[model samples]
Target: MPTPIIIDCDPGHDDAIAILLALAHPGELDIRGITTVGGNQILDKITDNALKILSFVNADIPVAKGAAAPLLGKLVTGEEAHGESGMDGPALPASKFKPVEQGAVEFMLEIIRASEEKITLVPTAPLTNIALLITAYPEVKERIEKISLMGGGLAYGNVTRTAEFNIYVDPEAARIVFESGIPIVMSGLDVTDKAAIFEEEIQELKTRGPVSVMVGELLDFYSIYGKKMGFVGNALHDPCAIAWLLHPELFESEHLYVTVETEGKLTRGMTVADRRKKPDQPANTEVLLGVDREAFIKLLFDSLERLDRQLGSPAGES
Candidate 1:
């Protein structure tokens, strides 16, 4: 049976690809809906981007807008990285998909309650919507299979020396989710940094086919922000979570007690995994620190190819 999942995201370029992967690999996962939150951009833009991406792939999934800001701090968006539109690089057509009337949290509760199996929460953005849903419906806690999130870093950080953008955007929300006692699979910077996209790969994608053309276009738009940030290539951050789900063997992780810092002058949102030499705290999460980059990228490209075909276009190298 395919694992049922709800992707709570902010539709960063990588987030767009992650959704495509989930929808494409029908045998691996069953997507319930997409919940948009404030992070890579403001709530409205991210939600709009999510709907747009689904439409691009001809997916008919429902969308729900999440919190406009974090639970305890002012909302901060990465306009510099994702642009004013959140998914600024591609010149996408107007989205045909529309958001449902209920808010993200409400939609989440209803989906989990109705699903026959425990739903997995894949959050590739700030934890605002996931935290809110968990808090609002404590009864759903035990029903969640696990949470797979993209944030944090065991050694270094992208947003701060010790934090990732998603967590930094909403530290309080992250704290709430981490301490919720649910099972967690954290694919932080430690793993995603390895999932880089080289120029040749993007070019190959462009020539491989039209799906490749779309991917190439997407990456072209995605790479601009990365170059400005002093990165040689763009990392497909969001897809790491989906890739981890598809091929857990490609990644190595440690079971540890993880906590998110909600308050600190320089450490808010930092995922403080107890990597200590000696500690009494029980392990709560499987924090991934390494990944097989070659395998993951292959999985990603293959899945994207599947989606292109399902969306009524030919995809190469499948």
Candidate 2:
């Protein structure tokens, strides 16, 4: 049976690709629903973006709108990287699929409580909704299989000198989830930065089909921020989370006890990973530390091709 999961995201450029990657593999993952959080952009924009992306791929998945702000702080957006609409590359047709009325936290609780099998949570943006779900309804904790997420890095940061954008947007929520005693697989920037598809690959992907062509355009715009960071191409940050869930062997990880710094003045949102050789803190997270970039890129293209086949678009038509 396919592993049931919920994709909680903000529909950032990479987040859109992550959803496409998961949906392309129906046999491997059964996505119960997709819930939007306020991260890359505002709640309304991202919720609509989710619907548009799903419609773009002809998927009929449930989408729920979530928190518009963080638990305790003002919301910080990634408009710098994602652009004003959150997904700012190719023009997407307006989606006929609308989000369900239930809020993200409530929808997640209901799904977890009602599902016969355990459900994994894949969060690719700020963790406010996950924090709210677990806190407001702590009883659902046992039903969650695990949380595979995209945030945090022990190596360095993007928002501040030590914080990534997602965590930095809502560090308090991140701290709560990190301490919630749930098993976690973290696809932090430690490995995500290496999961890049360069210009050559992007050019090749554009010819695959409509979906691949749009993905190529999305990367073209998103790569601007990556270029500012001195990368040859844009990093597939959000897709790294899904990639690890589907193909763990393509990457390497370290079992570490990690926590988000919520109160530090200059270090807030930093993932404090206990990497000491003989430290006594029990490991809590499988932190992805490296990836086979070639294999990662191949997996990405493979997903695009599969989705193209599903959409019935002829090869090399885009």
Give the best candidate by lDDT.
2
Evaluated at residue 197, the lDDT of candidate 2 is 85
lDDT (0 to 1) per candidate? 0.85, 0.92
Deviating ranges (above 4 Å) for candidate 2: 277-280
What ranges in model 1 sit over 4 Å off? 276-280, 316-318
TM-scores, one per candidate: 0.96, 0.98
Tens-place lDDT per residue, model 1, 1-318, is: 999999999987889888887887888899998899988888888898898888887889999998999887688888877778888766888899899999999999999999989999999999989989888888899999999999887777787888899989888888889889899999998888878888888877776645556767788888987888788867888988988888899999899888988778788778888866555577888998888778887887787677667656666533
Q: Give a tens-digit lDDT track for model 2, residues 154-260.
A: 98999999999999999999999998989999999899998988998888888888889989999989999888878887789999999998999999999999999
Model 1 lDDT vs. the true structure? 0.85
Model 1, position 143: C-alpha lDDT score: 92
How high a TM-score does candidate 2 get?
0.98
